[model samples]
Structure formats: C-alpha cells, structure tokens
Target chain A: MSGDHHGSSAISERVRHVEALLEARGLVDEGEIDRRIDEFLAGGSPANGARITARAWVDPGFRDRLLADANAAIREVGLSMAGGLQEQRLKVVANTEDEHNVVVCTLCSCYPIALLGPSPAWYKSEAYRSRVVRDPRGVLEEFGLELPAATRISVWDASAESRYLVVSRRPEGTDGMSEEELAGLVTRKGLIGTAAV
Target chain B: MPDRFAPGDAVRTSTADPTWHTRLPRYARGAVGRVVELAGHHPLADDRARGLPGTTQAVYHVRFAAADLFGDGDHAVTVELWEDYLEPADPSGGTP
Candidate 1:
C-alpha cells in the first residue's frame, strides 16, 4: 500500500463520484444489489475464491478440467458463479516456464469472481490497470518478474462477461508440496498479473 | 452529448465514496485520449453492494502508447477504458 493517505482518499473520492454518476443515471434497481454476481456472494470476503482455486492447482485432473472449462471447475469448488447464468464462458490460463500471465479488464474491475477472489487493491489501480495494458513489461518488472525475451507474455483483458485466472506455475522445486503450501504461493496479485506468489 | 464521460476525455481521480463501490485504477486519472469508443454502462457500486443486479459505466478504449504511460518504455501498448473512468485531457496536463 502507498504510504500516502491522500492517494488512498483520491481513489475513494473517485469511487464516490462514480457512484453518484450511477445514481444520477438511475442505473441500479436498488442500492444493495450487485452488478457483478459473485461479488455479491463473497459478502466482503475476497480470498474465498482464491482458496478454492489454489486447491485445484495440485489436482491434475481438476487442473485439466479447469483449463478446459473454468466455470465448471469453479462450481466444483462450490461457486454459485454458475448460478443461473448458464452461458458463463470463463477461461483459466496458466503461466509456466519463464512466461507468465496477468489478467486485466483495462475497462473496469472485470475479474473472475467465481474463481479468484476480489482483485488485489493494486490490480484495480490505474498504476496496474493502465500499465499492465500499456507497459506490461515494466509492470511485471516491479513484481521482480522479468519474462525472458523468448518467453511470450499474454495479457487477457477480462470484461464483465469474460473472466480469467492465471493458473500460476507451481514454483520450481515444489514437487510433493501439499495443497496448503501451494496455496501459499498463489497471491491475489499473481492471479491478476503482478506477482507469481 | 448527454454530459457522459468518455474513454479519452480528461477525468479526475476520486478521493471518497458514499456508495461504497470499488475504486477506479489509479494510473488512469487525468490521462487524455480520443473518444476511442463507448462501452456499456452498468449498475453502480451501491447497487452492487446491495446484492441487486448492478453494473458500472465502463467507457471506451482510449489508446495510449506504452511510453506515455510507463514513461521510459519505447514499446507500444493500447488501453480500453470507460466513460466515468475518464473526463477530458488537459492541454498542458502532465503526470500526477
């Protein structure tokens, strides 16, 4: 987090301004309803989704299914994300080798709430959101991750309809590691394209 | 021209919220762009917080060169943005 309270307040004020824009536009049916479905399900808890995703990392078949269809993969983890919206086309992309993956909705905070938890504070920042889309290499450098020139960097811009998850590479020498240990390596920022663990 | 904001327009960063919504990304504030295009608007943060079907005004994709955003990069990168996410650009606006 930045050491500047003013910086944080600026973000809050911007959020407030947007809310006012929404209200003035008569955009919502009510104040409590959630625009993003899974955001509502977590009820102030963000990491719940990440916990589910981390467990599936070690399960080979589960990982396969996840790579195949993230929506069902998450339902297996008890996500109501599949709640009624049958056409939920979610994709789980993994980062392996020297290559890495990061998700951004350069448009909005369009994260895969059904799988990963609420985006890390930095993930939603213009510092991240803009730089990741604009200067992904520079942003990744901040995380101490510099992709080899040979490695391919794929940034998935998640939208309200499309969500993405970075199935982080199980760090080197992690064989025989339990699911708990694996989870330790799956930081929220890693999922969003900032860090690996 | 309903007084709606666009992706490339100049917009100010927020410092507070009574509706308790998620905050906008930081690097975007005060940046300028052309009205690349308009994305749809969704229910606001307060509605999302209330468990109602909510959405936000996701604007257009304002294209920014990587050098402009990252400062030292010579690479090229593009940005897609929302309306409220931006306002209009400053004629002499510099980085914050």
Candidate 2:
C-alpha cells in the first residue's frame, strides 16, 4: 500500500525547490518563516483548551456561552484564536453519558490549531482519518476507549472555515477538584474525543 | 445573513462537480442528512479555491446516521457543509 518512497521524496524535493525559488526571488525570507514558526509554536496548546473546558465545567453560564458562540466565548476567557492568518471559528461539542462526541478531519487535518496548538501526527495520519469516520467505536477502542454498548458516538468532521473541540464530560469524583486540577485531566486526546478525561 | 435551512431541516447534499477543489467530501454527495447546527455564514471555499471573488454562504453541521453513511454503526457523522452544496429534500422520499 505504501507505494514508493521515492514518490514522497520527490514531493519533498519539489517543496524545497519552491521554497528555494521563493527565497531566491526575495518573495520570502528564512527569518520571516522562522518568525512565523515561532509565533505558531508560542500561540496555543491543549492546556488553553483544557482551561476553557475547566472553566465551563465549573461555570454553567460560561458553558452556555461556549455552546452558543465559541469564538467570542474563548475571547471572554482572555484567549483569542489569532495568528496563522486562517479562519478562526470554533464549534464545541459536549459529551454526555448517553452520547459521546469525537472530532476528525476526514478531508484533511483541519483542526483548531489556534486553541489546541499543532495537531499530533496520529491525528493527521491517513489511518486515523479514514478509519475514524467509518468505525468510530473501533477506532476509539484503539485509543483505549471502550464505550458502553448503550452509548452513541457522534463524530464531528472539521473543515476550513470551522473547527471542532470535544468537551469531555467531567470525570466522577472530580467534583471536589479545583479548575486547575480539572484542567490537568483534560488531555489533547480527550479534547479530540479519542481518550476520556 | 439569514440561513436557508434551520437546525432541524431535512436536507440532501448536492452531487456537485468534484473535479475542482471543494470542501464537500466525496462520500457526502447526494446523501440525505439533517441539519444539526447552523455554523453561520462564511466565504464559500469553492469560490476561494478557484481564486474567484468570494462571497459568504451559510454553513450547517449536517448529521448523517452511521447506517446511512457506512452500512451499520452506533454513531452519527456530522460534517460542516456550505449552503450551495445542499438542497431541501423532498417530502416524497427522494432528493430533488
């Protein structure tokens, strides 16, 4: 199935060729590219999303606001989806006991990069993308999540203009935990609905 | 901009030309689904991809039954699709 390594290597070479051409023509500079990389690296992480989810878990009003308008709601928490010059709208889906929610980019790796930082390699992998949509439960099991037979899964496919975030259900016995403690339990996988919180 | 379809509307995805760059997934074309959420208006990606003058189009989170999309499964696949790629499903059964 993995056709030829040379084919992919050719793609890399062509990409390098385009980059070199652009640089040679003064259309782009390595410093500008590095600065952009640094900006993206410093922009956001799963921790930011965890904090937002934690705040929502503790505050019902914020949860309502988040479900209503996610972009504005994140701004209310002092987090803005800026940088990368890409579309920034985000839609959050909450997991319930009867219905579980997961996110995938079936077309490509369209994710909430401004909220959860760069997506992990597994998320962008072809295996994850193709299998997750067809067999969500099976895929979740691979991620070590075995849902009850009665539970229904809802898979959200993100696209260019919009992104999705899965708000994992607050774990049991965490009622006494503070927002920071709760945030610590919100993994990137949990936010993506691969693993539970 | 006002949304063409509401959250609960039964709509069918249009089997539009897929030769060019489009956000509409190939698997979703001509499939019937219900609008789960109105994702607001945004620039039509189909237009943006072709380097044409872009205009806003209402987007919706359409939910398809797992069985409808992949034979059988205890799940639903919700995808964000633009307005132009969807048409109102007929009450008689088939997508017009």
Per-model TM-score, in order, reads 0.54, 0.92
TM-score of 2: 0.92
- Which predicted model would earn the best TM-score? 2
DockQ of each: 0.09, 0.76
**Tens digits of per-residue lDDT for model 1, A53-129:** 56666677888887776667766766645533454456667777755667777655667654565556666675676
Per-residue lDDT over B61-89 for candidate 1, one digit per residue giving the tens place of the 0 to 100 score? 35443344456544333234434455555
Scored by CA lDDT, what does every candidate get? Answer: 0.58, 0.84
Q: Which ranges of candidate 2 are over 4 A from the true structure?
A: A1-8
For residues A1-197, could you state the per-residue lDDT of candidate 2 as single tens digits? Answer: 12222337877798788888888999998667667778877867999889989999999999999988888898888887666686478898889899999998877787887678888988888788888989999999999999999999999988557788888999999989999999999999998999886
Query: Which residue segments of model 1 deviate by more than 4 Å?
Result: A1-46, A82-88, B1-96
In angstroms, give how far residue A61 of model 2 lies from its true place. Answer: 1.2
* Highest lDDT model number: 2
Alpha carbon deviation, residue B48, candidate 1 (Å): 17
